[model samples]
Target: METLFRICFFMAMMRFSAAEELKRNLNGVVGGNVTFPDPVLELGFLLGGRGTIALVNDRKLQIVEEIYTNKLNWNRNSGLFTITDLQKNDSGVYKVDSKKARVFYISYNLTVYDGAPTPAVETLTVSSDSCWLLCSVDKATSLLWYKDQEVQNQNSSASSLPITVHKEDRDSSYRCVAANPAENKTLHVNVRTACGFNETESGDNPKQRAYWSVIPAAIALIIGALVVWRVKRRLSEKRQTEDYAEVQINNENPQDGTFATSAESSDHFDSTVYSKLKLPEVTSAEPDLQATPT
Candidate 1:
């Protein structure tokens, strides 16, 4: 099944053109004149916003793009063409009309892969000549390339994974990618620190030393203040306790030589003393005698 699909895949790859009035949808996409309900076919085109592909007069046209490196112009023997990065510019209709195969041929539909890969140089160390770089792509593809960011020393391979690069190529930021001949797909590899290239540490040594010294000094001052506060509190508490005790002692202790004595007096004031006097003693007797005479 896969073989038949591949066989039909390379047969035709139509391009966008104004001469052919291709169907906007997939009804006109898979094109072959073969009459086969069982013949498998696989056709791949770069996917994008431009889904429109045509097969009339054969002058393929797409919006001009920078990294588009491959031209899978549909022809008689170009069985299958892989449009690497299905780009936004590739969106439109795709139509194929080939008379090579017979008995019901089913062509595949559009699959777009228009994302960029991340590629980078990992290490530029080991004498600058033996440095090795590691690149990773965001979008995976079978076609990989090692590109020097500067000087344009580029190498290609069939790998969508990490590709090892040399050190002399390290001068430029290098990246890994998965690309197709059509150059419709594009991705860059991620990059990081390189070996052998020494970057200066951020701060000055003297400045770092100064900062460290001040931290210890500040810590010492804080500790000293805390100790002094504790000692002063202890001393103040002791003094207060001593003063309170002294006041209590002073209040209980006998002072100077003063004495307070109570006197028992014989001379007393009586309220009935005047009535019991000798002159008043005869009054009662006189009143009684006058009453008897009356």
Candidate 2:
């Protein structure tokens, strides 16, 4: 009875070892290459079960299956398998067995997806107080929302999620993670202060406010320069007119030892005018005759 129990126990151990399944998950692009991990070679160790020769998908390596005829490659030293130009139809369970022991050495479950789509964020609605944003993808098994690289929503499991943006969150950055069992994609959105918010009443960041202030500041500087130039021009013209009036007054008063030449007054005269004055003339001989007679 003891010997029988030992044989039963050995058979149970064998059954348990045969029932063990090794799970491996892998992803590949539509037309990309994928390789299965190779089992480590130990000096005296056998993987999955004791074996001498390796068999793939229950077929001898020498006799390649039709599905893997030209697409499969194997490395003898590493015990690794590579498939080139992966197709959607090639996604399934791959098994490697030991020919001598007739037990599985390793099994791999591979799932191939077409490709991960690029995620995009869109603005749906905007109000004075808040804004609504949406992140979408063509197809996804789950969706994740992030704000500033931290997870925001953990319960979202759809292709799209609506994100609420408050006035205080103007400068916050949002991200979306769309994923499936095969692949995942991430997209980001930067929220600016001008997204339907009241920018004049304290909704902008320092940089944005400074940027907007530059426009008015530049306009003010230009206007000030124009005003200064106009005032200077007016003053210069007034000074020139005053000088001209002083010159005319000097010219009109002949008693002042200043005289205006015809060349200088030609520009101001419509036509030339003439003035006459007379003075008495005396002889010195009358005084000498009177003194000699006296």
Each prediction's number of clashing residue pairs: 47, 0
Give lDDT tens digits, candidate 2, residues 1-294.
999999999998787576556566777767777877843322212222123222344222443355556776666567566777889887776655444444444666767787766778888987777888887777755787888868877434566777787877766777788776666788777666325564533534465777888999999999999999999999989766644422222356565445553223334557544332222445456444445454
Which stretches in model 2 have alpha-carbon errors above 4 Å? Answer: 1-19, 22-29, 38-63, 98-104, 154-157, 170-172, 193-294
lDDT of 1 at 216: 90
Model 1 residue runs over 4 Å out of place are 1-133, 136-148, 151-154, 160-174, 184-221, 224-228, 247-294
Clashes of 1: 47
TM agreement with the true structure for every prediction = 0.27, 0.58
TM-score (C-alpha, index-matched) for candidate 1: 0.27
Q: Give every collision pair in model 2.
A: none
